[model samples]
Target: MRRFVFGALAWPPLLERVLGRAADLRPARLPGYAVYGTGGGALDPGTLCAVPDGGAEGLLILDPDPEDGARMAYFNGTDADGMVTEVRCGGDLVSARVALHDDAPGDGALPWDQARWLEEWGPLALDTARNIMAQYGQTEPARMAGLRPYLAARAWARQLARTPAPAEVRMATTAEEGVEILRDRPGHEGFFRLRAFDMRHRRFDGAQSPEIGREGFVAYDAALVLPYDPATDHVLLIEQLRYGPILRGDPRPWVLEPVAGLVDGGEDPETCVLREAVEEAGLTLREVQPMVRVYASPGYSSEFFHCYLGLADLSSYEAGVGGLDAEHEDIRSHLLSFDRAMALVDSGEINAGPLAMMLLWLARARAGLRAGA
Candidate 1:
């Protein structure tokens, strides 16, 4: 039997990739329905939901192959369910399958705006789709849905990685001129992703190096902030038990560090730090001084940091515990004198590298900041 599906929110590039070359598409319209945005992160307004209206315009896929149908199901995830419906293509009435949003709210839904969405979310959505489809045969659709947020974060990391940096002291050759990716073998997919690459890069002497296998731990870009009070010479640090140290066999896993959180897709780093300050330590920061942006580790990870010095008044604020319950965070906030924080750094008590770097940065600017205040 020939199969036809109506897609109201399907991006053309994504549709081409999912439906394959054998499928055909044409303009179509469904009567008594209108599309609305769902407003989710990552692929914001994740998928458009249909509500009763005079009509809605969309695309009709004609005779999609069985494999294409399966791939489409996986792409839509578990929140949408498929059903056969009739839509008009030109003068003809066509029967097609439409993916309905199962939990679409009845009121206050905004109309779908494809142009705006494409401007802000198109690239990230495409990149995220590439990762999600790569695991089609191996991962369940429901599990993939659960992994979508993390996948989107990883995609956001790629976008942030494109930021141009000073290359005066380093080679001017670009990745396009210096490297070749022969193949990519999938390794793992969860909160974090792992991928192995077979590649070669141009050496300084002008010859391509031998192709070798290398694996990378894909991570999100993080916003880290050190809250400081120039008036009292105090800083706020949060203590939490981290998994990395525990995995590395450290007996004392609880470590002190600056306020930090993963930068969500389409979110600015400055905005992220301010939000983290409130969530991690019940502090509302009005403004932040930029510190330095750097990679946590360049050798085998994609973790990057946007560090900042948050200006706040900590003279009367008492130290206490704070963290989001949904994230299972048990964080304790500590208000320490500038000298006391440095003493901990000297004693090797403050082991987190970002925190140490930020404290040193504050030290260099402390006198100037205080003098001005």
Candidate 2:
């Protein structure tokens, strides 16, 4: 049976894997069915259902081979278990099948936009699929669904680190030349992944260190902007519940922090901060000044940050609820004068590292920035 991919299954690289060859996609229609989907990441899902007078527009998979059918059954959740249906391919209404999910969005579900999906989610999903397929047979589809969200984010983080920087300097040693990865495996895959490694690296003394056992948390890059009203000398901070502290059993899990978010795959950090400013704070950013590009904790995580001081007119913006309903972000912004922010810092009410660092950086550069504003 040929697989007819109407959703993310059309992701090119993935399509090639499923179809053996990336067969030319042609205009096709499926009648008596409506396509519905819900999922932000690979974990979020899609399915097709029977609906009278409803049809979906998608590409037809020409003549899939037996191998293609088998692989499709393995990876595409619906192919493995979804109900078989009929689709109109050219003049013939051939028998086809779809996997349906109950969680698929209904009523307001937009038609599948293939180009948009490839642009925004293609890269993340591509990498996520590779990681998932790599651990195939050892894990179940249910487990992959659970790991999908974080794995997608981890893919973005990896892409960020892989972003090329203009030549400024060259290191004496690169991972290729100085490090040998004997065995590296996924230790855990959830909101974050635990990666266990057996490797050796060059030492400062020009000798190879013995093979070491180490594990690290695979992290994604995040955008952090400290919104400063250079004209009024005020800064805006956000407070939200954080799971890290709560999981640690800290008395306070609510964190006071900057307007921050994960940088989507193929999105630049600068653009990410601007997008986040509106989504998280309902404010537009102007003249964003770069603070630094550094790892949150280099020793054990790949979480990187593109810190910035975003200029905005927060003179009227008040402490209020913010964040996206779909993502369940319940954020509150606090407009604090320089002194008030400092008081919070002094009192430990502001404990998030990014908030504290941004505040400190602003204190020293406040005069320089306002001078230009």
Candidate 3:
């Protein structure tokens, strides 16, 4: 017999443990089960069902056990769709399986019993369920493909969870400051304005088109840097956790990016770059060689990054652990020769789009930057 796990309906702490373990077991698909689903309420049974069914076959549900039925009260109020969704969203199933060897919950907040599992997990479980299900829905094998509606059902369940949390925007003084704000408001939307919002204009009939905003919301209104040390033939790249890759199922989500951060209120972009360089990567940026200050992304997010080229002591600085501890930043700086860094970008080793663009910018200005250095 094969086994699968669901964390949503299981319990909160248990679910976290399960996800952590699941993360540990990389590049492997979890087992699938079935849902005797009946849908109602804010939870989308469809989305919940997709996790097991989409990735593997018939793993979300099992035949009702007479001995277990009395314990499965949470399944009682739910329909077949709801039961299955509860299971997927609950994630206890996954939690129970992956973390079976781990210690039981210290408190009653999460119970080991199956019936109590659904109650504790609740509709709030659907978000993680939807995320996992969506990942598998696109990739599920054919036999399990029929269970796709569970993904939809899970989505509905998530809507119910949303009623409680709701979405709201928070304000901040600067982009980095906005990161702090965003960290606090994990689920809710964040909105803030910073001093310098950079945009490029494509002249059309001598008139620039409506500006495009790159990156995400301009929540962190800050400056950007494209650091280059032509004398040392080196550049500064800072690595940190990124939400974009996290959403895309990347295991190691930290990305090596240019020395960039939010420009605090009353500070100029150049000042922001210099400060960020010292704080994030532990490098002293001496000369600021300005480049086209363009928005990183102009479509969805409001992050307007001001790109620049800075001359620094690439060899003197140690390329090791850096960043602010209060913010829980574990950034690793790489002081590589220009050719090596460009090669990494060219070979697709450097995945971040902004870093790639900045690298190319440095490539163009390498000669001049070196001459001046």
Best by TM-score: 1
* Model 1: lDDT of residue 347: 100
Runs in model 1 with CA error above 4 Å? 1-9, 19-22, 45-53, 67-70, 102-108
TM-score of 1: 0.93
Q: Candidate 1, 149: how far from true, in Å?
A: 1.3
Report the poorest 10 consecutive residues by lDDT, candidate 3. 181-190
How accurate locally is residue 349 in candidate 3, as Cα lDDT from 0 to 100?
A: 75
lDDT per residue, candidate 2, 1-373, as tens digits? 5456667775557667544577766566777666665545443334566677878666666665656544555555433645566778788887655554543347756656667666667766677666556555666766665555556666777767765445457455667888998998668655666889999998878899999999987778898999999889898888899998999999879998999998765567899899999999888987698998878998998888899999998888877898999899999988889879989989998888888888888889988878977
> In the order shown, what is each candidate's alpha-carbon RMSD?
2.2, 5.6, 18.2
Q: Give per-residue lDDT, candidate 3, residue 312.
A: 72
lDDT of 3 at 316: 72
List the candidates ranked by lDDT, beginning with the highest: 1, 2, 3
For model 1, what is the error of residue 202's alpha carbon versus the real structure, in angstroms, after optimal superposition?
1.0
Which one wins by TM-score: 2 or 3? Answer: 2
Error of 2 at 143 (Å): 6.7
* Residue pairs of candidate 1 with colliding backbone atoms: none
